[model samples]
Target: MGNSKKVILLGNFGVGKTSLVRQYVFRKFSDDYMTTIGVRIDKKMVAVNGQEVSMIIWDVAGESTHQKIPNSYKLGAHGIIYVIDVLRPSTYLSIEKEISSLEDLLPNVPIVKVANKIDLLTEKERIEIVNNLPLNDYVLCSAKNGSNVEDAFNKLAESLI
Candidate 1:
């Protein structure tokens, strides 16, 4: 239960990376938007298969491209949660490229591809967007509404074990 794993949150700016972290760790959401300059770290213990796993979540500052992120922020990562705002096409248009870069940087590290802000989309909109994105597998989450936030993190935690 004392096992700790490093997890990184990678995505473009304003894709709700911090919001997802806050929602998962603190169960709180704020309306104000603040840019993460470098990186923010938060710790949450998740019960993965009845065992507590300490997730050291690194909310790195969002960059337009994965190549722009500092290597220091990505090293030693056990997993990554790549989040995308469902309402913002720009956030996910280059997902295929970004994910490929991520794989090259951290080979064998599991990434939980997430589509955040699903609460803002209707069922039809969700289906349409999912069909349009270049994604193999992804989880729909809404940080503002606390929907599937835990599941996304837990899935990553389980993979770490």
Candidate 2:
């Protein structure tokens, strides 16, 4: 086993951070939307370039006017997975702000943009959003159906290596 990598899943409320983690970790899905009150951690083993890597994921509570991402939780992250809901344009716009805040706290770590709920968007909408975003690497994922979930995780791991 190689060194375990620390990663974080961050986004606004109801953007499906828990759902994404649940799908990736257990290959399961639920229709409910429950806000995460605090940080939740999960571990998974993945192989990158023939080397075994353990991913320690920290799914932080969604950002809110009353609650912000805890400063203590942002320390020592190897990378961050910033998730946005495709059906909510506001969530997309907030990505920059989230990245900016996170960068201020954990500067120099890699960040992977994820457009979640792809299953809810039309083809044209997806193209339009993807084309305009500045992300060099992004994924249209559906945690509900387990689509591209692993790919998103693998891309982050590969970038770390």
Candidate 3:
């Protein structure tokens, strides 16, 4: 398929938005940490149900403390994936508020709730964190280890269709 769909990755700083994209698109991960400026866009072609789908992923900068999100980055989005590092409780704490803001900005676009860095957490720890966060379409993934990375993309792509 030649069609392109805009998908966005939303989360706090260093929640692995870029890392997830790297894992999915390039199948690579790094130990270094780099903060995204305004936005970094990536593209990946994936097959869902035997049909090729192009996902244009927008990795937006982490929302500043007590600041509103940029409207321009959210426009024309087909799907949104909110990533949270399981080790960081603070990341998932304000998810309810974030989701509300996103829903208001892009009303009907499907959002996928993702808990990344699962490889760092114990099974019990993962459950404890996920239980606290709101779950619409939730997935647990480890970008460093390539666990459920494809599933996260497929879940969003499936919703796009």
Which candidate number would show the highest lDDT if scored against the true structure?
1
Candidate 2: Cα lDDT at 61: 89
The whole-model C-alpha lDDT of candidate 3 against the native structure comes to: 0.85
Which lDDT tens digits does candidate 3 get at residues 22-111? 999999999899988888989998787888889998988876321356677788899999888888878887788878878887899999
Which residue segments of model 1 deviate by more than 4 Å? none
TM-score of 2: 0.88
What is residue 7's positional error in candidate 1, in angstroms? Answer: 0.4
lDDT of 2: 0.83
Candidate 1 lDDT by residue in tens digits, 1-161: 34989999999999999999999999999989999989999999878888878899999999888789989889999999999988888999899888888899899999999999989888998899888877778899999999999989988888998
59: Cα error in model 2, Å: 0.6
List TM-scores for all candidates, in order. Answer: 0.95, 0.88, 0.90
Clashing pairs in 1: none
Which model scores highest in TM-score? Answer: 1
Q: What tens digits encode model 2's per-residue C-alpha lDDT throughout 50-85? A: 988899999998874212766778788898898888
Clashes of 2: 0
